[model samples]
Target: TWSTDGVINEYCEPCEAIVEGELVEVPPLEEREEFSLDGVTYEAFNTSGGLGTLAETLKGKVRTLNYRTIRYPGHAAIMKALLNDLGLRHRRDVLKDIFESALPATLQ
Candidate 1:
């Protein structure tokens, strides 16, 4: 969705480097966020936010099913970039700060 919408430009520099294969070392950062867990690092590129197109394709085909952990637009890419740039696996608060400062709030 984001790619089609040209949202990649909104992604942070670190994420762009990772996607371009310019980042090699990933380490821990001084600040961390709640979602981040110690002893673990994350790297991602265009990870699905949820079932995505599958949800529409499977509409009405099944029942009693649920899915979670759909990453917000550009969130995963930025996160991976942050992890690699900051040398930390998880920096939940820092990530939050970065996004909050960079992105405008949306009512939707």
Candidate 2:
């Protein structure tokens, strides 16, 4: 039962090593602009908060790095539409409230 399979061992290494290793700062998200048929302009930005931070920390240590958000498939579309409708594109507090109201809290 003590077979040291390299594949399994490498895959099962301590998550703490990646989670607690290095701390890095995340740069601003990359953005681009697009216009709808009605001439409504909108800005699209990447979801890079913790992901960017982790990528910076693991830049050289890991071969590849990426970040993913856990949300409903249409979350972005819903958010964009809400922001456009409310004219609160850059309002962080309002955005936070809108999102928080929609998503349940994992921890108190």
Candidate 3:
């Protein structure tokens, strides 16, 4: 039987077509602060699960929402070193297909 009735998750809200708007990304920190590194910098990149439409709807109501691009802590550094320093996003589609073909999916 085909049905759209049992699709949306517990936290999901039917927003004004999540397709129409650009993804909403909010940094994890509620308060914005400045930081010092090699060059003067401020804390901005934060991580949160932007699983589909989660962040887009929570705008303003919640101080912060999960960022889509940035990773948390070591994740950002590691991924940057791999994806940027080494470069991987370019061939991601091929890698994804290979990985999917090699590893079998398990249903819980």
lDDT of 1 by residue, 1-108 (tens): 123222322232222112122322222221222233465443333222233355445445644222322333455545556656774335455656665677776665
Residues 59-106, candidate 2: write the lDDT tens digits.
Answer: 558754433333334445665565556655546556556655665555
Clashes of each: 11, 0, 1
For model 2, the stretches where C-alpha displacement exceeds 4 angstroms are: 1-46, 61-63, 84-86, 97-108
lDDT digits (tens) for residues 1-108 of candidate 3 = 311212111112222212224444332322233455666443533333335566556545565434333223444454345344655435555445554565566564
TM-score of candidate 2 on Cα atoms, chains taken together: 0.38
Worst 10 residues of 1 by lDDT: 12-21
Better of 1 and 2 by TM-score: 2
For TM-score, the strongest prediction is 2
Alpha-carbon TM-score of each model against the true structure: 0.30, 0.38, 0.35
Which stretches of candidate 3 lie above 4 Å from their native place? 1-49, 67-76, 94-108
Q: Clashing pairs in model 2?
A: none
Error of 1 at 5 (Å): 21
The C-alpha stretches of model 1 lying farther than 4 A from their native spots are 1-45, 52-79
Q: TM-score winner between 2 and 3, please give it.
A: 2
Residue-level error in angstroms, candidate 1, position 14: 19
